[model samples]
Target: MFEGHGVNRSAAERRAASLTTRRSVKKAHQAAWLVNAIRCIDLTTLSGDDTEGRVRRLCAKARQPLAQHIVEALGLGVVTVGAVCVYPTMVPHAARALRGTGIPVASVATGFPAGLMPLHLRLEEIRWAVDQGADEIDIVITREHVMTQNWSALYDEVAAMREACGPAHLKAILATGDLSTLRNVHAASVVAMQAGADFIKTSTGKEGVNATLPVSLVMIRALRDYGEATGHRVGFKPAGGMKSAKEAIAWQILMKEELGRDWLEPDLFRFGASSMLGDIERQLEHHITGRYAASHRHSPA
Candidate 1:
């Protein structure tokens, strides 16, 4: 259905740039926005050195992303991240850690960062993660399919992965940085949603470039159009290289502007960032006290 679709990079860039300059939220409103961003964050850790210890720690942080002081000072209650994301093997640890907390454990499957593996193996990985208690699966798409304009192949692959996920929500990561064009990014977003992706993500946080606003604009527009055409609402996630409260607020503003406040919720939008929580906490702390504290006071995520 996305054949011959085109995107204007210059127009997307201009619009993305305007999101930062055109809107401003301060004091209580900014603090509320930051807290909402926390609710929609996929607090992630996907390194070669990832261990159960580290995963447990990350899950602990996800359970209580902000300090008690911050939560109390802000007059908020029961704050937690949307989910804790980790490798397939770490799913069990994350699940065990977050059990009964109502926080889903998300795993990256289908050969994340690069989906160059055999299709069956990739599908199997999804089932394995689900069996290990991953409530959500983030699967990477084969950039080759998009680059070669093989929309059918991409659709079939994602559909198979969706089935393999069983009951887990499927998040298709387009990794737009590798797609080479906004047009490709738009097409991939539509195909992934057509293939039953519950959410369409921008990156795996391991690309040469990840989650730029311009690329994200293209994907968001594609999903918006798909929703209009099919009556299905898909979620959006922009992962990687976003590490500031300003960025957290900017992306939320983009979603709110483009798709309204419905997209601002955790169910419809998320930031696939690991280190972003620290900066958000810092900003909220400053809002509470009218001064910034040392960064180390906020624990790493």
Candidate 2:
């Protein structure tokens, strides 16, 4: 298996910068790419005031992310988000709302956002969410372990969380922003995958800094290296701060460039986003009708 490796920040920065300056997709191709992005979104509502009603509405949007006219115009059929992500308490509502849609309900557990709770409590949260019908569980790693270079503890923590998830897929949120360096991001990626993370994610969307191109590059590289060593493909998610259709395309391009076209699918990549769908809808509308719709017109609610 591949252990943690060193990352040359300067080289990674140059590559990440090139991702933007390179030629972009246009017209029909751009519209298709945005549709693919829509299918890979973990339509999320992580607000403190989130209620069952709100989660149900979010699930409804996840089931039919695009308007009927837009779907017909684009020649796309029944496009849905990759999944619906909600807090543990609202998992049942999301599950019920998304029934028969085949869109999984992903719950953020393990004392999400700021994961400073006791280990036992965190583990129980995972089991509880799984029991509540979450098909996927996104858990946060103890930043202290990564900060202090306690690879053993970090690996063990994630491994246990994976077990607690039972049949539910495990997504280890590295909270890369708080790790403080690209090297730390790389190391955490390796450890999390080693500990059986199905997907390694960037942020909780509440950090001082969240997902950025440079940081995503480091994580993707680590994922590639790990796949090479173990022959196991791990997924990548860039959550938080990705609000525009342009940002979604940039990340899709990154996955296509770094890991090949296979990583572009919902099984291998996901955008933890809420409002992103609206912009993508607008862009897709412009692609079809030669005009952009107002934001309110494409609201998920």
Candidate 3:
């Protein structure tokens, strides 16, 4: 463990911290590689879109060019779909649909995008999702606790969430927009990393202010420092409001320059974009045929 006291413990911690820094300085470019990757292939895939006639339209989307076009783009690999995120209720269907495919099913949990529920219930949600075969679970930290500067409570709670996660990866959402400051984001990132977050992600995509490059830069830099201060290999995910090949590449460049090459890997880095897939197709089309083809209207595109 990199955290401890006493002369011997301190020396060991220093060595571990040093090793971690050097490795992150090396892997920052790849492990956290920003996949211009995508999210929201199906509009109805988004939660809170429920309406009386919504299902009929969603069923239509499944049959039309929307799903086909999106799938075909995923096939070309000019881009990568970060993960296929869906509502808790949709995890089973998404798991079945995405099975045998390389993409991970990252399901939002912990009464997600809100984080206003009790601890036991939230943990049960994580347990249930993992049992259903969800590959990843994205849970937001309790903003109220964070606001009160209760590090011990926050750390223990996050640790519990981590234990509940078991094998399924935990993408701890800082909900940067709500936290609303580079300093808080940095502190939260450090705490989340310490608490066993596989990846520290930004907002839940339901927030108005999602991932910003500047915010991403701050978050990644903080993670870099934390990784240096500790040996654990924590990752970063700048989700929400991400769209466009240019945007992904820009963040990729940022990760490479600021964090180093190891940050580029899919395991370490990814984007959570509901509409970025269309932008990828447009970029691909330009690459393949040298024309900026107009994307058919779809949710988030």
- The model with the greatest TM-score is 1
**Model 3 over residues 231-259: C-alpha lDDT tens digits?**
77787888877766556666666666767
Displacement of the residue 160 alpha carbon in candidate 3, Å: 0.7
Total colliding residue pairs, candidate 1: 0
The 10-residue segment of model 2 with minimum total lDDT is 1-10
Between candidates 1 and 3, name the one with more favorable lDDT: 1
RMSD, each candidate, Å?
0.8, 1.2, 8.4
Task: Kindly give the stretch of ten consecutive residues in candidate 1 with the minimal lDDT sum.
Answer: 1-10
Candidates ranked by lDDT: 1, 2, 3
Error of model 1, residue 254, in angstroms: 0.4
TM-score of each: 0.99, 0.98, 0.76
How does each model score on lDDT? 0.93, 0.92, 0.66
Clash count, predicted structure 2: 0
How far residue 86's Cα lies from its native spot in candidate 2, in Å, is 0.5
Better of 1 and 3 by TM-score: 1
Name the Cα RMSD for model 2. Answer: 1.2
State the lDDT of candidate 1 residue by residue for 24-76, as single tens digits: 99888998999999999999999999999999999999999999999988888
**Residue 53 in model 3: lDDT:** 42
